[model samples]
Target: MVAVRIAKETGLAIDRVTFKSSLTLDKATLKAVPAGQCVTRVTLEATVYGDVTEEQVTELGEKVHVCCPVAAIFRHLPGCEFEPVWTLAKAE
Candidate 1:
């Protein structure tokens, strides 16, 4: 399972937070038998009504990334492997 947390530290009355995620299963053979692997990807999005600086958003995102439980768990596991990617876009 993948988890995402979003927080709006500064914003006007239109501040909003959203999360998106998807899961997929893949089959692979390690030695001879078949093994199933579950892959989950999560994305977090936020919109602030007022003007928000890029530096502030980057700082907040870094804080959230550091404190995220899922990221901690993935880091603690020694043999687990995963692919992680992150992106940020301004609202239109």
Candidate 2:
């Protein structure tokens, strides 16, 4: 699960944000492991948008990646894994 924060520090009313996913994992390795095997992978993709510049979006995304609770949980726990891949569209 991914959560995005888009509150304006400049006192602007940027109340709208968008999240999108363009890619997902084809298969998860957890299924092959024994039922007791703790190893697992959780995959996801998301995009966020609001009344903000590209730079702001990038910063927010970076912060979200750094501060996500699920990410932190997986990092501290043993045998859990995550593989993230990103695709960028060409600018027109």
Residue-wise C-alpha lDDT for candidate 2, range 14-75, written one tens digit per residue: 33444432222224644675543444554444433335555555565555567778556545
Q: Relative to the true structure, how large is the alpha-carbon lDDT of every model?
A: 0.42, 0.46
lDDT of 1 by residue, 2-43 (tens): 122344333312243344444333334344443322332223
Q: In terms of lDDT, which candidate is strongest?
A: 2
Off-target runs (Cα >4 Å) in candidate 2 are 1-14, 18-42, 75-92
lDDT of 1: 0.42
Model 1 scores worst on lDDT over the 10 consecutive residues at 34-43
Q: Provide backbone clash counts, one per model.
A: 0, 0
- Model 1 sits at a Cα RMSD from the real structure of 5.9
Stretch of 10 with least lDDT, candidate 2: 83-92
Candidate 1 stretches greater than 4 Å from native: 1-14, 23-25, 29-50, 77-92
- RMSD to the true structure for each prediction, in A, is 5.9, 5.6
